[model samples]
Target chain A: MSQLFQHLEPSDSHFEPDKDEVLNAIRWNADGLIPAIAQQYDSGEVLMMAWMNREALEKTLQSHRVCYWSRSRSTLWRKGESSGQVQKLKAMNLDCDGDTLLLQVDQEGPACHTGRRSCFYVRLEQNKAWVDQAPLIDPKTLYTNKP
Target chain B: MSQLFQHLEPSDSHFEPDKDEVLNAIRWNADGLIPAIAQQYDSGEVLMMAWMNREALEKTLQSHRVCYWSRSRSTLWRKGESSGQVQKLKAMNLDCDGDTLLLQVDQEGPACHTGRRSCFYVRLEQNKAWVDQAPLIDPKTLYTNKP
Candidate 1:
């Protein structure tokens, strides 16, 4: 494998470290959360970014689905639980300082609540933001009952 | 062009808007900064993530080079100014809610101060983070004058 491959193939040996040790390796901020960014696996388009607490990270490790710590809701937010725009985890990476996470995911549908394939739809051009891409689907059609 | 093409080709009509209006469209948080993620232009590998304030963002727009707000130093950190690891801006995009910015750049050298190709080098797998990459250059050699 190249020296820069971000994907980690499972270790050949049955070498499982202590779960706590694994979690402790991360340098969570004072708020006990880390910034986590999700990218579309094949296209490499960065879909969205959110925060992840230990529980959210653990859940993602177990379920192969992305979960984020919702600072606004003060709870764990599972990707696409209501909208069905789930993100299936292909790989998870910890940054060098352990303060950030990057997830390579197979996004089920539009990754943004606004129905864009990526949350980023506005291009910065001529000192302004230009709406370069239209929403793939209507935002109203995604959510059913959430207020 | 597909709806997912993140690369922003420069506009031809020269529709320039007020700089402050462009800046105000971004939802700066309480800290008056936005999370900026840089991705390798051709490879699609995310290089590094940093914070950018209005000045740093403005400087980048004017120079076509990447600059970041140094939270610790309290000044604009011109990337590669000392380390020679400059990032040439190729494209820039603002996220849906206008809270995040993504930069596609041609990285001249290792993006990490640690000399890795990217700041993200540890892959979370089999319940832990595995160092999946090696530093491309010696960190010590990159800085000769900086303390």
Candidate 2:
């Protein structure tokens, strides 16, 4: 356990849990990762979901930003390297058992790949039909010719 | 197990594992949910992460979309309902143990609340310095006076 992880319990109201405490407190699965939920700090809109390993968690804490582990290539991936949409970490919260994490970030751009502002752009009507709400951002403009 | 949950093998490549199979397959500690990673199907950008309970998992599968169990509100939530950034279900792949899920979604908007396309917007340089990559979108246009 690193000294950076030590902090107070978020539920205590008086106890402000630090990065280390939040990371170490969580019940990471055998894979050494935890589920992190990114939400709009003000509007309470969920942006997306990603995995966070110890190192990524630490980086997020130290930087006051959000970091996640990429399972596809099995590596540490920082957001916005190519797209430029960044998450500035404002506050981090842990679930009761420390199995999940909620990150309040200062987001920079759209949070989805389709060029919209969020990954969640579909809507289900009262009849249970799924409908597209908005047009996606043209990929060409978003990727900056990176392909 | 319901008929929907049957016929799902942890090793089946083509078949998207159902909620039961996903729960049974993963290495969940005591929590009923697993760590599911949401990514853009086309561009392969990482989005956000959230917990998937049995209901959320089933809902996502049934609707051919992404859903999650919100710990704070203790409810099953469909992505993009309020924000209009819906995750259209492209395909669902479970990790080896079924504890992790790779959701390839036709993302509509930004996956981050900060109006970025992906939740991963912050980047760390070689010197461990954090850098912001993604830009923020105008929320007024996105929400469009939907109070």
Candidate 3:
């Protein structure tokens, strides 16, 4: 137990080292959070990036589903609760300094609020023009209650 | 053209006034980027979050596919070009602040590196145990030949 404390810096009071020390071993920004990138486990398509405070990080590790700190609401949110496009966690990884996280998951439906499969549908054209593509699934079908 | 300069601030050099004005009109953080979430257009699964510099933001908007700044590499990256789980743009929206963006996309396949459909597959059970729900797809089926 004492050995675990050795690798941890004093500023890391929020993190409790465990077997998967690498996950808990990274340095977080002053906000006590790190940027986590969620991607498709098989296809390797990047879905989104969110901040994870220590609590959220632990919750993610404990729950296996990804939880993130919503900067807008300043609260912890479980991905896909309202949309039903839940991300089933497959693995979690940390970058070299432990500032970033990669989450691999199993997705059920569109992840973006716009009702598309992913949130990255937009792109820049050769002439620097903005264009929108066809939607795969209508958001109205998923969230009938909300607009 | 001078009228456009009226809204320009000293810090706006890195961003185009037209784009910045629009992005700022929508809502952005001090960093001049919005929190855009990426989801699987097909599965409706949430994938990851990435910061969009003005250039990347404009690129995504113009192209109708997702483009983001890779903080890790500090470079521009387009989805699906490497892994093949490309995200085709469907739609885009700005949050109340004009800083946050919501993108709707058509995801081709797995959006995660671990071969899962999404990035939030792991969840902690009530008993404080790590649980993995989904299985991974074979990489061979996803990539015919490495690109």
Candidate 3: how close is chain B to the reference, as a TM-score?
0.68
- Model 1, which residues run further than 4 Å from truth? A1-19, A145-147, B1-19, B145-147
Candidate 2: which stretches are off by over 4 Å? Answer: A1-11, A16-22, A124-127, A145-147, B1-147
Candidate 2 at B49: error in angstroms?
A: 10
Better DockQ candidate (1, 2): 1
Across A1-147, the per-residue lDDT of candidate 2 in tens digits comes to 222222111111232333333444557878898777676676655566678998998888777767799877698877765677778886665543455666777777676555555543323221232223232455446666331
User: Which is the better candidate, 1 or 2, if ranked by lDDT?
Assistant: 1
TM-score, one value per model: 0.84, 0.48, 0.49
Better of 1 and 3 by lDDT: 1
Give the Cα lDDT of each candidate: 0.77, 0.58, 0.57
lDDT of 1 at B51: 94
Top candidate on lDDT is: 1
Candidate 2 local lDDT, B8-107, one digit each (tens): 2111222333333334444553778766767677766556667788778768878886888877778877787667878888766543223555577888
- Tens digits of lDDT, candidate 3, B1-147: 133322332211133234344443544456665566665555655555557877787787778778877766778878766777777777564432233455667776676554555544333232332323342575446655334
